[model samples]
Each structure stands twice: as structure tokens, then as C-alpha cells.
Target: MALHNKIGKIGEDIAVKYLRQEGYYIIERNYRNKFGEIDIIAAKNNYTIFIEVKSRSSENYIELAQSLYYKQIAHLRRAAIFYFSEKNIHLSLIRFDLIALKIDPAARRIDKLKHFKNIID
Candidate 1:
């Protein structure tokens, strides 16, 4: 994998580990549909979460946030709707989350990880 892809994969693994630690049970990773890929899907306390994961090896947090545009978020929402309908899953408490990670790929270390819960609202 290229450096960026490597960083992203590593960052995702780190995010999954952190989420498990936080009492969330993972249901999926890299769930895909026409809209795109939902990086992580998990459940916690009766809430099903759709997570968008952004990862970077560079030290530019602003860049990472800027990379995800409004259109992308809209696509995610649409994709979430498709996921619910396709999987035949229903729950009153559903959430959209954003996980941002800054990592050192060489060492496979997560320098920072931020979980922004309910990002859609």
C-alpha cells in the first residue's frame, strides 16, 4: 500500500481498538454502497453508529477536516439510509460519528485520535 493508504489502514485499526475499549461492539468496517464507503459501523447502548474516519500522517488537522466536504457528508447520510433499509435494521437511536486520527506510519503509532460523536447534526 502507498503511504497514505497505509496510514489510513493503520489509523482505522487504531480507531477500532479505541472504540472497542469504549464499549462499542463493531458491526462492520469499510461498509460500501453506491454512495461510498462507511469506514466503520458499530453499535453501543442500542445505538447504531456510522463513522467517517479521516486519517493523516502529516500534522495538519485543518487539512484533514477540510478534506471532507459537505457533499461527502450528504453522501454518507444517503448511504446510511440505504444501509438501514438493505440490512433490515431499525433502531430509534442512530448516530453519525467522525473519527480523526493523526498517526506515525513508520512506528504504527496513533499520535492522536478524536471521536466526534453525532457529527451529522
Candidate 2:
């Protein structure tokens, strides 16, 4: 894999581990459709969460927040709608999330992991 891909995969693995530790049941990873791709899907407390994982080696949390654009959000929402319909899940049971990770790939460490829940609104 390319270096960036490897880094992204590692960041995703870290995000999944953190979510599992926090009692979320992982349902899917890298979910894709005609609209776009959702990096993670998990269930917790009766909610099906569609997650977008963003990783950067040097940027801080503020930069990460700015990186999530309206266009990407729109794509995610459309993809999530498709996911919920195809999976027979109710719209009311869904949540949109963004997990931003500041990782040190060489050290295999996450300097920071920010979980932004219900980000669609």
C-alpha cells in the first residue's frame, strides 16, 4: 500500500479500537455506494452511527475540523440514506459522526482522537 493509504488504515484501526473500547458495536468499515464512502459504521444505544474518519500526521484539531467540507458532508448524507434504506434501518435511529485523528505513524501512536457526534446538523 502507499504511505498515505497505510497511514489512513492505521488511523482507522485506531478509531475502531477506541470505539469498541467505548462500547460501540462495529457494523461496517469502508462502506461505499454511488454517493460516497463511509469510513465506519457502528451501533450503540440503539443508534446506527455512520462515521467519517479523517487523519493527519501534523495538523491539529482545528485544522481537522476545517478539513470537513460541506460538499463531503452532503455526499456522506446521501450515502448514509442509501445505507439506511438498503439495510432496513429507520432514519430516526441513525447518527452522523466524524472522528479525527492526529497520528504519528512511525510511533504507531495517536496523538489525539476527536469524536464529533451528530455532525450532520
Q: Which candidate comes out best when scored by lDDT?
A: 2
Across residues 16-114, which tens digit of lDDT does each residue of candidate 2 receive? Answer: 999999999999999999999999999999998999998888889547866889999999999999998888766587889889999999998999999
Query: How many residue pairs collide in each prediction?
Result: 0, 0
Report the C-alpha lDDT of model 1 over 1-121, residue by residue, as the tens digit: 7888888899899999999999999999999999888999999998999988898987765456557789999999999999999999787789998888888888999887778889787
Q: After superposition, how far is residue 110 of candidate 1 from its true place, in Å?
A: 1.0
**Which residue ranges in model 1 land beyond 4 Å of their true spot?**
none
TM-score of each: 0.93, 0.94
Candidate 2: where are CA atoms >4 Å away? none
Clashing pairs in 1: none
Residue 115 of model 2 has an lDDT of: 92
lDDT, candidates in the order shown: 0.88, 0.90
